[model samples]
Target chain A: MMIISTSYHIFVKEFVSEFRTRYALNALLMFVVTTLSIILFSIGQESPSIDVLSGTLWIVIFFSAMSGLSRTFVAEEERGTSLTLRLLVNASSVYIGKLVYNFALILVLSVIIAVSYVLFITEFTVKTFEIFWLTILLGSAGLASASTILAAIIAKANTKGTLFPVLAFPILLPLLLTCINATKLATEGAFLVEAVKEFQILISFTVVMIATSFLVFDFVWKD
Target chain B: MKTWLKIAVSVWLTGIIIAGIAFPMVKVPQTWYEFPFIPGLEEKARNIIFHVPISWATVVAFAMSMIYGIIYLRKKDIDYDLRSVSSASLGLLLCILATVTGAIWAKFNWGSFWNWDPRQTSIFILLLIYGAYFVLRSAIDEEERRATLSSVYSIIAGVTVPFFIFVMPRIMSGLHPGSLGDEQGKGPVLEFKMAPNMLMVFFASLIGFTVLYFWMYSLKVRQMRIERHVQQITETH
Candidate 1:
């Protein structure tokens, strides 16, 4: 109860700070817009298949994550509030709080990207909205859970910006692959039950990532 | 390592190599020395003795690195950090060797150097994971922080290994032997049986390469220890 309450407090703090300056949100939105337009312009008048569009949508979300999500911890470090947070909050609470924040952030980013992707890409149509939404939800959860701990890890590194994606891509490969497949199936009008395997893998992946991050975040957080 | 162990490893690996290369692949095996001809694999099946073992060693090395990382986190001993890094570097080397050898074998068998097979994709991901591990290690300037952070990163990476190397590959259909729908597939490589003599050499190669990995890991740790000691001595003076 105590941990939950503390983490909730921290989560609220994170949102308040994020909304005040809109730094991460603005950067993330711009990244998504820029990449989507660039992709749209380059493939002008050629209708790429659903496969390519699905891949491209995830790629946009992923790079936008790489660009913007690190701010959760990196901002705290930059503002010199990490010490205060360390002294005031336990490591697990800080982790959970930041994880929730990242989850919400990534969820919003993915939805925006998904909406724009469907609107902009003529060939990309989702016959099954159920699987498509489920994929987005689970993929964002997995991405956010995986990247939160990684953000903490990279916060201590010298090359903060480049290290996040370098450290993130390989670890996130399994998740990305499953998300792409599920999205592909969703676009092809597959039934909800048709993506059972992908759903299982995605759920397990997110659970394992979150559990391991919880176990190891202490080591990464403390001196 | 002891002198006798080193001698045994050297001799054992040499014998395996000789047997692996010199052993004849014949259609019928009347004697213990001759291996049964595995259709499609033919002469290329010899790679199982050499290539498969190296990949096995790679797994062992990465597992060891993860183990040592866990130990370091628990004990806060820099020595364990050294051990972890040493094993990881060795794992990376063995992984590269396995990939290159597999590629060469694939060129003759699959008609392409890179098939993007499930196994190939998994190994490629493993390489990226560890490569990122090293990059993470190098980006930290402080000793204890670097050790702790990298250990945590390695543990996270290690947890995902089974998913990448084993689960994902088998779940997806591909050219790999154990892949889904491979049982009834056209490739005889799926049903290829290993003769008893060939199996013996394969196990022997696995054991030998694993021993060699430990030897290399110990040497690396010792070198790093000496370097750390020398730096401390110089700094004090």
Candidate 2:
């Protein structure tokens, strides 16, 4: 219970700070829009297949994550608030706070991505909304958890920009693969029942990621 | 290395090399040649001597690296960190060797240097995972911090190696051969199709590769330890 309130307070702190600067949010929107427009312009008047669209959607989400979520811990580092925060609260609290914040950011980003895809891509259609949305939710959670931990990691490194994605690609491979497959099924109007395996994979990936990151966060955060 | 251990390794390596080249030429009954093989793999199947053992040795080295990484995290000893990197670099070298040998075998057997098979895909991902480990190492500056962070990264990366190597390959269909469909052993050996002579050479190669991997690992660890000691002594002066 104390952990929850501490985490919530930290989340609120970050949220208020983000609202004041709007740095991450501004960067995220600009990136999403620019990349989305570029993709739309490149495919002008051509109907890409569902597989291409699915792959493109994930690529967009992944890179957008690379651009935005990397800032989660970088902000603390830049503000010199990391040490102060470290002294103030438990490591798990800070991790949970950051994790939740990133999760919300990713959820919003996914919705924007989904909306942009429908408006820009000519042939994009969601036959199985339930499956698609479920994938978005689960995939976003997995991506947020993964990137948050990794962002914490690279935040302390020198060449952070390059290191973040390089470290992320392999870890995110399993999740990305599962998401693409599920999205394909959704695009093809497959039953929600058919995506059960993908759901299980996403769920397990999220659980394992959060559990392991929590176990190790103390070491990473404190040290 | 101890004289006896050095002598043993050299002798073991020489015996395996000689056996690998010579034993395959031993007059096996015609039935041995009659066994099913891929189109151009008849002679190329001999690559199993190098390819299979090198692949196994690479996995062994990776497991060694992860174990050492775990120990480093727990013990905070820079020596374990050195051991971890030593084994990792050796493992990556073995992994590259496995890929090259595999590509050569594929060129002869599958008729293409790159087939994008599931096995190939899995190996490629394993390479990336290990490659990322070094990238993470280089991005950090401090000695102890680099050791700590890289060890944590190593354990995380290690979790994916098994998934990529074993589970992903099984889930995706491929032309790499040996379906291993609920057979007795792991991989092609499970098919139990090899001749007794082939099995003997295979075992010999496996032992030789394992011995070679450990030899490289120990040599690297010693070199790094000496370098660290030299650095500390010179800095103190």
Candidate 3:
């Protein structure tokens, strides 16, 4: 549909803008690497099971993603042109654009994280590794949707600086829970059939959040 | 200054006081507690007395505030906006009370006041989300912007509250009740086992909290209205 194509185009543009922005990509990579190293050092040369490292992988990815998300709209304010951008598009469009862009960023970051998690902490078998990738796909979609909406809400506020994550994390709690559970089950080689409920919960959380944000975002977006 | 509203509140308060006095004096119909309570659970039955009602009432209040927020945002009416915030503030108050009571209940039933279990942790997160909402409101200065932004945030934040509270912990490995999403949960059916007087206590709390929500909501609307009138008069001179 026209709507989908429009959002996809906007989403691509949003990604290019963010990718060109300095520090977000680099800082996220550094944070992910640092967290992996820290966990490796903490666990030592001892071969902790992949099961143990799985949740940590998602946690660090989430926090790093969160750190980037915390800055999403704020940098625009300092430059003083954010108001122009809002004037240019539908408010809901901005949210969709930011969400797709952030989703892609997190997906890439999570893959790199999975790789580092394997190298530094545990030897993830190919099977568990693939599941880890899928979990991140689901989880990152969730993280992106949550942060993008909250980013819009706080975009112009006095505390635009801090409101992003404080409002987001609590909302993201269930997604975080689901991602961890799915990763654990998958690492242990439990059948996807067994983890169906957890998967459903994550998917439902993503769908509901996206729908709710779409409906209420316009009335609430402040200039 | 409304005679009927004052009389209603007094009557409600009197009923609440009487219910409070009579509940403990009356014995439970057949004590679910007549059996041996586990190490921390002698008071488990008492949780139904406080926790469930408070959360139910708070969620009701929060939902009402959400409706007002939508109305205000749609109309840009200042009175409706103030009503939204006041109702939200009342919702937040009830959220805190619900959380504390749930914590107390958790201590008795789960043997620890804080468990990373889904139900307890999720509600705590709900409280946190709403707390941050208040923080968001207070940080702003312009009444129009503040009310507009917060009303929007409230609806968004409201969605997150239930998502986190009811969904997250169960999906994760929390050791709390209601996480499994099954009919056969661990606790006794919270609504049953009333001493008629205890039911009275429960209903009384519900009425008191509801009335309190309305009273605070009206007061906030009146205050904002007065401030607007004062501004208009000063400008006229």
Candidate 4:
């Protein structure tokens, strides 16, 4: 109960600080826009298939995450506020707080990207709103859960900027594959029942990632 | 490692290699030594004795690395960190060997060096995971911080190995044997086929390579320990 309250406070702190600067938000949004434009320009007037568009949508989300999500811990370390954070809350609370914050950030970013992707990319149409939305939700959860601990790990390293995606890509590949497939199914007018395997895998992946992050965050946090 | 174990591994691996290569595929097994000729696999099947064991050893090595990572986090012992890194490096080496050998086998069987098979894709991702692990270790100059962070990363990566190597491949339809909808009945290459003699050699090769990994792991840990001691002494001076 105490842990929950402490983590909630930390989450509030992250939310306030984030909105005040809007640093990660701007970075994430700009990244999505820029990548979408580049993709748009390269394709010229040709409309790619839904398969390519679904895969492209997740690619944008994945790279946008790679660009922005590491800021959660890296910023704390950069400002030397990590020491103050350590003094304030326990390690697990800090982890949970950062995880929630990152999840919320990624969720917002993904929804915006999805909206823009649908608006700009006329070729991309969602036949099944249910599957598309569920994929985004689970993908965000999985991304946040996996990246939060990795953000902590890389924050303590020498080269913070380049290390986040390197460490994240392989760990997140399974999730990406499932998300892309589910998104494809969504675009193809598949029913919810058709994507049951993808959903199960997504749920299990998020659960395992979050549970393991909690288990090991102590070692990464205190040190 | 014990001297007898070392000697045994050397002899065992060599014997398995010789048998795996020299053992002839025949229509029917006249004796215990003859291997039954599998219809599709034929001669290329011998690659399993060498290739499959390396991949198995890779999995074992990653599991050991994760185990030691957990121990290091609990005990704060640098030795366990050393053990963890050493095992991971060996795992990386074995993983590459598996990929290369699998590619060679694929060239003959699948008509290309790269099939994007589920098994191939999983191994490639695994390689990326551990490759990033080493990059993470190198980026941290402080000894304890490096150890702790890398250990944590290893644990995270290790937990996903099952999802990648085992679960993903089985769920996705692919060229690999035992994949979803595989007409081979989804039991993997080991279960549905293999004559008795071939199975014996395969199991022997598996045990041999596993023991070989432990031997290599111990040697690596000792080497790293000596290097650490040397660095500490020089720093003090």
Candidate 5:
């Protein structure tokens, strides 16, 4: 209980720090806009319907999440503040803090991408709000597990920038697989039951990764 | 090298002779030569001889590397790290060999060398993941940090190997051979005469490849240790 609540607070604080020190979100916003503009341009005046919009939005979300992850846990190391974190917080809490911050960031990015997708792409709007929100919820949480865990791994490495992607991609494959499917279903305006298996898998992926991160973060931090 | 390897060479040569001449003559099932194996698998049996052994050998190599990685972490010994890297190199070689052989076999069987099937894609992904581990190691300087990070990466990557090799394939559907688990290269496989003699040959080959892996791993560690000494001496001078 103490671990969960305290970590949640610390996560918010670290997120604020990430916003200030890293300017990660600002850079990511630019990347997102550039990506969409390129997609729109390359798409060549043939306005991509809602289907293309959903894919473009997810792609932006994934890349921004990945780039943001490279900086996720490094702020503590940058300030030599890991020791302070270690002294006060359980290692798992620190991981949770990082996880929560990453989840929030990815979720917000998804929303921005979603809105941009609607504004820029087509007349197609999400028909059932539940499907749209559910896809976002599962996809965001799933992305957090892959991003935050990989960030912890890369944060400890000598070359965080290079190693993070190599490590993250393999781990993220299954989650990405499910997220794509879920998004597909939502885009097609299918009922939740139609994509139930993919959603269940997404949920399981999120849980297992978060659980493994909790266990593995202890070693990642102590080392 | 000759004087030192006399016993090993003699033993290997003797095993080859016995396997090539006597065993196949005596114990193989008569029907093996009398009939075809599973309709059109006759020619492909030759592939099993190379492919299965290589994959089995590579899996052993990966496990050896992983063990050394754990040892390096446990002892903080660079010698073990060298062994780990060398074993990984061997594993990578064998993995590539298996992929190639598998691709050729697929071209023969499935009518295409490359299909974006789950099995094919997952194996390719695993290959990239390990290749990237080497890239990650080379991107950094400082032997200690490199050793530590590479060792860590190897451990993590090695863990994922089985996840893709066994678990991922089972999770989805695919046309990859040896996928049925129990049917992997046994009974009426490509090597028709696999009765008693081929089994012996197969097992012997598995053992022989394991020895080769250890020999190369030892040599690599020795070279790394010498290089470390040379660097240290030059620095002191």
Candidate 6:
């Protein structure tokens, strides 16, 4: 109970500071717009298949995540606040807080991408809103859970920018596969029951990732 | 380190080498209609003798790496860290060997050097995950910090091994042979489709490769410990 409030306070603190600085926000939005525009221009005037659109959507989310989520711990280390954080809060609290921040940040990014996909790609459509939304939301959480500890790990390294995505790609591959498949199903008008298998896989992947992160984040966070 | 165990491992390796080659050739006539294997793989299935063992060795190496990584974190001993990285490095080597051998086999059977088969994709992802571990190791300069961070990263990466190697492939259709509905139309893998002699060779290969993995792992761990000692002496001077 006490841990929950402490983590919530950390999240609130992160949210306030983020709105003030807006570095991650700016980075995420710029990445999304630039990548989406390039994709829009390069593939101009061709009606991409639902599969292609689904794949492209995930590519955009993945790269945007690379841009924004890597900053979660790098910001602390750069500001020299990591020591202060270590002193002030428990490792789990810090991890939960950053994880919540990342989850919210990516959720917003995913929503923006979904909306932008709808607007930019005229033929792009989701036949099942629940599956589409569910994939995006759960996928965002899974991505956050996987990347948060990695961000902490990379934050201490020298070539952080290159390290984050290289490390993240393999760990996130299964999640990405399921999410892309689920998205494909939704776009192809599959019902929730029809796509339930993917949903279950994604849920399990998220659960495993989150649980593993919690188990080990203390070591990564403290070190 | 026991002398008899060492002798046993060496003899096992020798036996595997001879049997892996000779048994496949002599166990049954290569041209017999009585033989049971995927028809095309009848001869080239010999690759399975080396290929399956190496892949299984890779998995064993990885599991050991993760186990040692957990120990290093708990004990915070540098030797544990050394064991962890050495096992991972060996795992990466064995993984590459499996990929190459599997690819060579694929070229003969699948008619292409590189098909985007489910099994192939999973192994490729495994390559990336372990590849990133080495990258992570080299990117850090402080010895203790590097050990701690890499251990944590390896643990995180280890969680995905089952997904990439097993669960993900099972969910998708692919060219790789599996228990049911394998792309090659080979039914369940463990059924009577396996000849008695083939089963014996398979068990021998599994045991032989496991012993071989442990031999390589211990050798690397000892080498790393000596290097660390040398560094410490130099620092004292």
Candidate 2 chain B: 10-residue stretch with minimal lDDT: B31-40
Clashing pairs in 5: B45-B190
**Model 5 Cα lDDT, one tens digit per residue, A17-90:** 77576688788889889888887788776756665566666777777788877887776688798888888888
Off by over 4 Å in 6: B23-38, B165-171, B183-192
Candidate 2, which segments miss by more than 4 Å at Cα? B24-40, B165-171, B180-189
TM-score of 2: 0.93
> What are the candidates' individual DockQ scores?
0.71, 0.57, 0.55, 0.72, 0.31, 0.71
In candidate 6, what are the lDDT values of residues B6-105, reduced to their tens digit?
7898998787677666653434445422335545467676676689889999988888888888999999998889988898999999999999999988
Which lDDT tens digits does candidate 6 get at residues A19-89?
A: 99887888778888999999899888888788888999999999899889998889889989999989999
TM-score of each: 0.96, 0.93, 0.82, 0.96, 0.80, 0.94
lDDT of each: 0.89, 0.82, 0.70, 0.89, 0.69, 0.84
* Candidate 4: tens digits of C-alpha lDDT, residues B1-237: 999999989999999989999988888889887888776778988988999999999989988898998899999999999999999999999999999999999999889999688889888988998999999999999998988998899889878877775446534568765555466636777785887788999999999999999999999999999999999999999
Per-residue lDDT over B1-237 for candidate 5, one digit per residue giving the tens place of the 0 to 100 score:
344564684587467445534432322247432222434454464455457767777778778877887787678878888888887887788789888888988898879998765656765766776787677677667776667666666655544444344335434556555444324433323433455545666667666656656676667777878988999999999
Q: lDDT tens string, model 2, A1-223?
A: 9999999999999899889999888889999999999998988888878888999999999999888888888878988999999888999999999999999999999889988887778788889999999999999998998888889888888888878889999888888888988898998999989999888888888887888788777767877
Give the TM-score of chain A in candidate 1. 0.98
Candidate 2 lDDT tens digits, B62-178: 888889888887888888989989988998999999999899888876689987787787778879988998998988889988888887777666655544443364346666656
Give candidate 4's error at residue B70 in angstroms.
0.5
lDDT of candidate 3 over B11-72, digit per residue (tens): 87676655443333312235522222222333354555456666776777778878988888
Kindly report which residue stretches of model 5 are placed more than 4 angstroms away from their true locations once superposed: A19-22, A45-58, A83-90, A123-132, A156-159, A188-191, B1-36, B158-172, B180-200
Q: In candidate 6 chain B, what residue range of length 10 has the lowest lDDT sum?
A: B26-35
How well is each residue in A163-197 modelled by candidate 1, as lDDT tens digits? 99999999998889889999989998999999988
Interface quality of candidate 5 as DockQ: 0.31
